[model samples]
Target: MFRGLGPEIEHRGEIVVIGLGRFGSSLSRTLVDMGHEVMGVDLDSANVQAHAGVLTHVAEADTTNEQVLRQLGVAEATTVAVCIGADIEASVLTAVALSDLGVPNIWAKAMTEPHGRILSRVGAHNVVFPEAEMGQRVAHLITGGVLEYVALDEDFVLAEMTAPASLVGVPLGESNLRRDHRVTIVCHKPDSGRFTHTDRDTVLSPQDLIVIAGRRKDVDSFGPSRR
Candidate 1:
């Protein structure tokens, strides 16, 4: 899958995405684009019908209801994303319900620091504040180089790129990227996130994605290693 869910992800048994809001809708789109079979569940039949073509299955039900989720085959899903926005209650409830169902991974949405803290306390695998994080990402992208930076911590950020034409034929250890770009080369991806390219030794072809990290501004200014 595009996000490096790994090669085994193609064996996707099933996937249930709860809530048909903008966030959930977009995520389902991206997952489908990644060539995975996804099921979108929501309380609104109209919303569920809207994504019927995009997802393998569309179920209109309250995901927070354990029985409804079970009927939707959520327990078999390797991952479930709860994208209820504003209604943190629904989001938290859905995450908790999914966890109880033995879903391998449960992702919840949070609107604030307190919400994140609470969601983390509830046993959710992860809490996402997408809008805020995306704003920061777009802001950094507009600044250039680190167009889609995602912070991993207070001090570390993950960035993306089309391998800088300058650093075409270089390998990691010899690149000294940390000293020059103030970022660490985490992984290399060829042609977007379509596949992991372990052969960093292969001269970088155009549009290879370099996943890197460093301090906020430093990572933002960091470009592909200069030849």
Candidate 2:
């Protein structure tokens, strides 16, 4: 039976990853690095061999078959990600199998909107477009002076950038950043220190790193060139 079908997927749990292609492989590796137990399944023997030493358990199996997935212990998994690439048919089928097995917290990768819709309908709790998201992230980094950019949603973003000249030497409370720029500095880190929560009294140094959260346009405009 499906269990713990919560709104959010916990990072620490037993996860079954189908497909050992680039996306699947990378995901499995990261999960293992995070100290999670991972069972990686792939149809390709080469892929299975490549990750045999890394994953807690890896097998070459036809994940499109419900019995095969169940035999691989996918049915009992708390979380599973269908990361099959290119072969949309296989991806959908694998997702269907996972759903039939009643595994909770199914995550899937979709290459297109239609494919994503199908995955969602077939019981994928979350469908992600990795390529499209990455392209958007890279575009933001190339355009703005931000050292890092994360789009929390379509409109809101969190950006990390160096403290501009205008912000240096001024306590955040005295600056009209929120009213004028419509962005809030979440935290700041000095050249030699770790990041810490920011407050109204927090003053910025010329080399301090600041993470700001706001609307995308506002965050992009709050860069070093902004006055």
Candidate 3:
């Protein structure tokens, strides 16, 4: 029934989003915009009505019920995200149902450490704390020359930062970044060009924007201010 929503829908598998709260709704809409066929499920009738026509499909159903989820073809979805952060019981139950159905990827929103652990044990492939992650990103942006920060794990991150003065004209092989700060420069963008992968002989320019990956502490130690 859902065809022609976007060209990307033709190639990508359907995505099932449970819980029509702010996070779930936003995720569904963004995925739709990206050309994926998204089915949004929620227990609230009002929420389903509110998102009608905005997503590929909107159903008011209790996702904790495995039968209801199956009726909506959730098992066929390539990925399912349980975005019920407030109700721990409901979130856990929904995640369990998805897992029991052998959903390939189950991403759940967790509110606390214990909650995340429970979700992981119950079959959630990925547990994310949106608020906590956003706070860390904001802290990084305000602290140094960091333009963007993407957390790859609890300790490691991929960060984009302005080239420090000390690095200008220094060859990548001679910079000793791995030895001095324990960070690796993955790529760089010159003053007026697209990003390019770095090589050992690549020299840093004052106006370059570099992307680095390492432990959070090591990345902070290699900040532009430290030069």
Go through the candidates in order and give the C-alpha RMSD of each one to the true structure.
Answer: 6.0, 3.6, 6.1
Segments of candidate 1 deviating more than 4 angstroms:
1-12, 144-148, 152-154, 159-181, 184-212, 220-227
Q: Which residue segments of model 2 deviate by more than 4 Å? A: 1-6, 9-13, 224-227
What is residue 117's positional error in candidate 3, in angstroms?
A: 0.6
Candidate 2 TM-score, true structure as reference: 0.90
**Which candidate would rank higher by lDDT, 1 or 3?**
3
Please give, for residues 160-212, the per-residue lDDT of candidate 2 as tens digits: 88898888998999999999999999999998999999998999998899999
145: Cα error in model 2, Å: 0.8
**Candidate 3 residue lDDT tens string, 55-114:** 988899999999988898998886888999689999999999999998877888888878
Query: Arrange candidates by lDDT, highest first: which order?
Result: 2, 3, 1
User: Which lDDT values do the candidates have, in the order given?
Assistant: 0.73, 0.86, 0.85
How would you encode candidate 1's per-residue C-alpha lDDT over 107-176 as one tens digit per residue?
A: 7777887887777776676677777777787876786666467777656677877677766677766666
User: Which candidate should be chosen as best, given TM-score against the real structure?
Assistant: 2
Question: Which pairs clash in the backbone of model 2?
Answer: none
The TM-score obtained by model 1 is 0.68
The TM-score obtained by model 3 is 0.88
Off by over 4 Å in 3: 1-12
